[model samples]
Target chain A: MAEASDEQLMLAYRDGDAGAFETLYARHRARLFRFVLRSIKSRASAEELYQDVWMRVIEARATYKPSARFTTWLYTIAHHRMVDHWRRAGLSVVSLDTVDPPAGDPGPQRHAEAREVLTRFAAALETLPPAQREAFLLHEEAGLTAAEIAAATGSNEEAAKSRLRYALAKLKSAVDDG
Target chain B: MADERDPKVSRRYRELGNEEPPPGLDESIVSAARRAAEHPHAPLVTPSGRHRWYFSLGAAAVIVLAVAVTYQMQQEQPDPFATGVSREAVKSPANGRARESAPPAADSSATARPEAATQAETSGRQGAAAPEARMRRDEAAARSLAKPMQAPAVETPQRMLERIVELRKQGKHEEAGQLLAEFKQRYPGYRIPENVVRP
Candidate 1:
């Protein structure tokens, strides 16, 4: 079941196989929600954006063709939705809540250290430009290569790589200092 | 594939992406996706393109043509039984050349006392009897002079039509209709008057 390619599953769904769509939904649910949640930083709005992305996929099932990777197409829809949301909200920089420490059985001192690192990382992510942050999200969350990011964001591969580089550098510097 | 940034930081960020959104959000979104997939988007109306308009235009043209033809036909039919025949000559038969037509005595008897034709016909039968042959001859001659129109063997269609009317008056409508039918078959293209055909 897991071995079936995304395109194959989507094609099955196109042929009216409801279970195939369920598989597709399960596969992308966590990753796509996280992508939207991280971008918007508001759980409620992220849920709306998340539902919108999946609706776009469902609406496009009939016209779905395997021209590109499913993730690339999925993230493209996500990127467009995010852009629309940003435009509607009229926000250039996304505001994020302070990051909580990684959940674990770590000692108090280690937990504080993880919290500090996460807080700095979150702030760093907020400070990056929207396109650059999008590139980074596509890379880390959607697991898209630079070329896939380029296709998703309608940019050149070099630009996608540059944005990803900038995002990673700022986060790395924050981690080292924190 | 060449990353300008340190690989360890990027790997750590990718691991941070493992931080899932709330479980409820995941379930809701997935359920929505599946539900949406179950209820597919309604397809839009298929464009009729120009085919429908083309047929409509064709139908409109046909209707217009039919109406025009009907109107033109109505305008053309001044009289249903009009055969385009020149009746002027027959109506004004008193032409300058009428002097060369039928003899005066025959024309006068035919035009004046139409009943004299029966007397002339009866006189000829009496002239054939031997008992008063010579006397009847003189009487028949005088009758012939009075009713010379009956001596001619020519039968006109006008006379035939009048006889048909007379037959109808005497309750011989079937015979009259048979005669008219024979007249129609004999003169296939003749444009008989409506009264003549169904009188």
Candidate 2:
């Protein structure tokens, strides 16, 4: 069969096609797991939440809609789940200090200086307000446009733009000052 | 100050953004998705239908028990003052010999109809409380029934797709598209061909 679109795959899964779900999961899983891992800062929690998110998708299969990009919807679910987890755990909304970039493989040549800079970058990300950080990640990491980010986050275009701008400024400052 | 800033900073930040996530993440996610698929009917993030059923059944049982108890109590006790004879009088010897043998205090007590009336009024007040309890039971039943019986309609691919179309028309195309993709993946058999998505 021809490769299906994300929406098509979701529709297929809804109709009891397990292969479609596997396709969808294969396509978006890494990015989503990384997204959650970055936000929550715990591998175990990320794994648990990751499982929870997919389970939600499975449960929601019957009602899956083609209204948004599958990835966006998936991320939104992940976002909400992460927020709920944080609330239940009595943790504050992610702070700026906890945002780390994807971990690099350990190597002698990967200088301590680069690691320090990346660590600072992560911290700066954690410090951003949830909206700003989400906007920045969607734009910078996911390659979404400001308008797209706004739609995913349920914010207006202007607000999304403002968040991106703020996130960039903060990140720049953190790198420069460090 | 702005002119002094290095353009490389932005470039470097952007470059760092694209770094691939750790290996095995995708496999882990796929595993999770597989696990989820295996147990499709697990309870939702919110309460499940079974929980609601249990609640409804429990409420019904309580109401039935309360009503039965009330009926039994009503049947066991007859109206006191209206009968014009003390329960004690009926319980005593059937002949006039018992009355003749009864003390004057007993006769005075039997004549106190007002007190008996007051006691009956209190019983009526107690009965009146039952309706309020019954009303509460009814309300609980209504509430249990008020919740939608099945999973919300929004969970369906068609509904989600419709919502996406609406959002798209409203210039929320990104979100609309995202939801559409998610829905499509979840329900692969229900393809809304790209051409017909808008119409």
Q: Which digits, one per residue and each the tens of the lDDT, describe model 2 over residues A80-138?
A: 79768878773332333443443566565565566577666666777777777776666
Which candidate leads the pack in TM-score? Answer: 1
Best by DockQ: 1
- Indicate the TM-score of model 1: 0.54
lDDT, candidates in the order shown: 0.66, 0.60
- Candidate 2 Cα misplacement greater than 4 A, ranges: A90-110, A176-178, B1-199
Instruction: Evaluate every candidate with DockQ and list the scores.
Output: 0.22, 0.09
Error of 2 at A102 (Å): 9.7
Interface RMSD of each: 3.5, 6.6
Stretches of candidate 1 off by over 4 Å are: A92-98, B2-7, B11-199
For candidate 2, the C-alpha RMSD (Å) to the true structure equals 31.4
Give the C-alpha lDDT of model 1: 0.66
